[model samples]
Structures are given as structure tokens and as C-alpha cells.
Target: MPLNFAHRGSLTEAPENTLPAFQKAIEHGAKAIELDVQLTKDNHLVVSHDHKFTRFNKNVTGLIKDYTWDEVRQIDVGSAFSEEFAGTNLPTLEDVLDICPHHLFLNIEIKNIPVIYDGIEQRLLDTLSHYNRTENVIVSSFDHVALKNVQNINPDIDLGMLFYYRMLNPWDYAANSGLAIRSLHPNQVYVNQTFVQESKRHGYEVYPFTVNDVNRYAELVDFGVDGVFSNEPGVFGS
Candidate 1:
């Protein structure tokens, strides 16, 4: 069977990336937990999908880059969802990693690899070294150069390149890089049997993004794409 990733840690029943979400994934027997990473002003790598904190606080509209880790921690990441989730916190990658046992692997997405997070590749390496999990990690990105940089830092760890839309030929880029494009994160609308066949034919795995509909989830699985990234992983599992 293709790997079943607990997208953002069983996010259907929990606030995405919260400890609750990750715990739910582990309990549900997911093999790996994938997450997004952003850097705080204090050089902390937080596991949030988007860099803006505004979703948590309407009045909070500044770039996360503008705040220190301490400042960012004071806000309520969960209350934005519901009062029940009010105390749910934004977690540092290290915070979550320490609690993860030997059974799990971390798929870390480098969300936007611009100058702000320039030294981030090295930082992630250092953090992974602390846990001795460099071998257990997979670094991925939409930015090919950043993926290349990550590969440069640690060639052995698996790397995946994310795609948003279909192009004339997507695998061409991944092949040119000399990087094994294990997965492609294309939009769900663009995924069909033809795309899946082409991806596999090219030796690439297809796992499209942000798909939550149960019927559509099954449709993709039937199409033979490897897996999916969803805000509601539990729904598909059903």
C-alpha cells in the first residue's frame, strides 16, 4: 500500500499542528507526521502552515517575521477555531519532535525559503542532529533551489518537491536536479488517472494537497496517486 500520511496530524478533529492533532495521528497508527515550518524573530522554528498569525487574532496582521518567539507564543492559536481549542498553542518543531517516539518520522516542509529563513536549512540540520534523526527526516519544498540546498546539506535524507498546478511536463524539473522526486504536491483538481500514471511512470510519487472531501479522497486513491494532504485526514480514513 502507498504510505498513509496523517495530513497535519489528523487535523479533521483537531486544530492543525496542535499537540492534540499529532497525538491523534500517532494514536491512529500513522507512520509519519508531516508539518510546515516557519521561523520566529528569535530564530525558533514554529510548525505553522502559514507564516501569518492573523488567522489566530484578527487584529494580529503583522508578518510572523516581525515577532520574536516569545511574542508569538503569547497568542492563542486554537481559539481562532473554537473556544474548546482556545489554549491550543503554536509549537516549535523541537517541542513536538521531543515527544515523538521512535515509531514516527518527520516530513518537514520548508514553507517559503526566502532570505528571512536563509540560514534555516542549517538550523534544521542542527536541530535534527540534536535528536539524531537526520536520517529519519524528509525535507520538502515548492522552491526547488531550497530543496537543492537541503539536499546539499544532507544528501541521504529523502527530499520531496511540491507542485501547485499542472504544467506541460513537471517531472522534467525534478529529474534535472538529480534529486529523486519522491512525491509531487499538485492541486487535487489536476489529479486524475492519467496524471498518476505519468508520475509513477516517471518514478515519482503523487500526493496532492489540501483535499478534504471523503468521496474525492477515495477517487484519488482509486486513481492510484500515492497519498494526500488534507486538513481532515480522519474523514478520509473513514
Candidate 2:
């Protein structure tokens, strides 16, 4: 069976990317969790999926980079999801590091596109080093340049490239990209049996994103994908 990564930390059970969601993922038996990281105005590393607060907080308007950590934390990120979770605050990357068990695999996607954070790769590496979480973690990004920066800073740190669109011979692309990539993460729609096999044949692990349907999950497993990102973590017993 392929590993199932809790997308945004068991997002169905709690507000996405909040501390409650992450804890719920652990309780739901998720061994792997994928979350997004963005830099705050004060340079604090925060856990959030959207650059703007529109999805989570209608009262708050602006990009995450527009506010300091203190201001970001003050906004209620959970009320939009549920009244029970009202007042739930956004969590910092360090906050997640403090809560999540060391044994769990972390796929931290850097939300750096459209609004790039200067030197975010190095800052992320520094934060991981401080938490002693230098291993068992894959830092992914849609911005290949940011990923290259990560590789330049620490070649030992594993890098995963995130792609939304289907590409021709992605494994060959990765091989020629000059970065020692650890894995490939594509939108689940683009994944196929040949894609999985070809990627693995080229010595790369394949993990597709945001797969919530059970039948689709089974199909991906049958296709020989290494893992999948899902909102329902416990559904596949991962």
C-alpha cells in the first residue's frame, strides 16, 4: 500500500494548516503530513496554504507576508470552517515542529510563488536545523529556482518538485535539471501507471497531491505510486 500523507494535516476534521488539524492527523493515524509554509512580514515561518486570508478569514484581507507573526496569530483562522473551532490561530512552523512527533514524515511545501520571499530556503534550513529536524523531511516547492536555492544551501536536504500540469518525460526533466531531487509531486489527475513506473525506473519516488476519493486512491496505489496527499488521513490507514 502506498503511504497517505494528510493534506494540510487532516484538513477535513479541522481548519486547514492549524495546530488542531495537525494534532487530529496524528490521532487519525497519519504517518505522513504535508503542509504549506510562508514567511511572515517579520520573517517568521508560518503554516498556511493561501497567501491571502480570504479563504480562512473574511474579516482579514491581505497576503500573509503583509502581516507580522503577532498580527497573523491574532486573526481567527478557524471560524470560517466551524464555530466550534472559532478563534483558532494560525501556527508557526516551529509550533508544528514542537507538536508533531519525530517519527512522522513531513512534506513542507514552500508557498513562494507570485510573492517570493527573499532567502526563504536558507531560513527554512536554519529553522529545521534548530529543531533537529534535518532528516525525514522533504521540502517541496513549485518554484524550481527556490528548490535550486535549497539544493545549493544544503545538498543533503531532500527536495521534491511540485507540478500542477502534466509534462512530457518528467523523470528525464528532473535528471537534466541539475538538482538531486528526492521525489516528484504532481497533481493526481496527471498521474498514470506509466508515469509512476517511468519515474521509479529513473530512481525517483512519485507522490501525487490532494487525492480525496477512495477509488482514486486505490487506482493510484495500483499504478504503483509511492504515496498520495489526502484530506482524509485515516481512510487508507496511512
Best by lDDT: 2
Please estimate how well model 2 matches the true structure, expressed as its whole-model Cα lDDT: 0.91
In candidate 1, what are the lDDT values of residues 64-86, reduced to their tens digit?
A: 77888888778788887788888
Best by TM-score: 2
Task: Write candidate 2's Cα lDDT for 1-238 as tens digits.
Answer: 5777899997888999999999999988888889999999999999998999988878788899999999998999889999999999999999999999999899999998889999889899999999999899999999999999999999999999999998889899999999999999999998989999999999999999888888898899999998899986655345
Give the TM-scores of the predictions, in the order they appear.
0.90, 0.97
> How does each model score on lDDT?
0.77, 0.91
Candidate 2 Cα deviation (angstroms), residue 201? 1.3
Compared with the true structure, model 1 gives a TM-score of 0.90
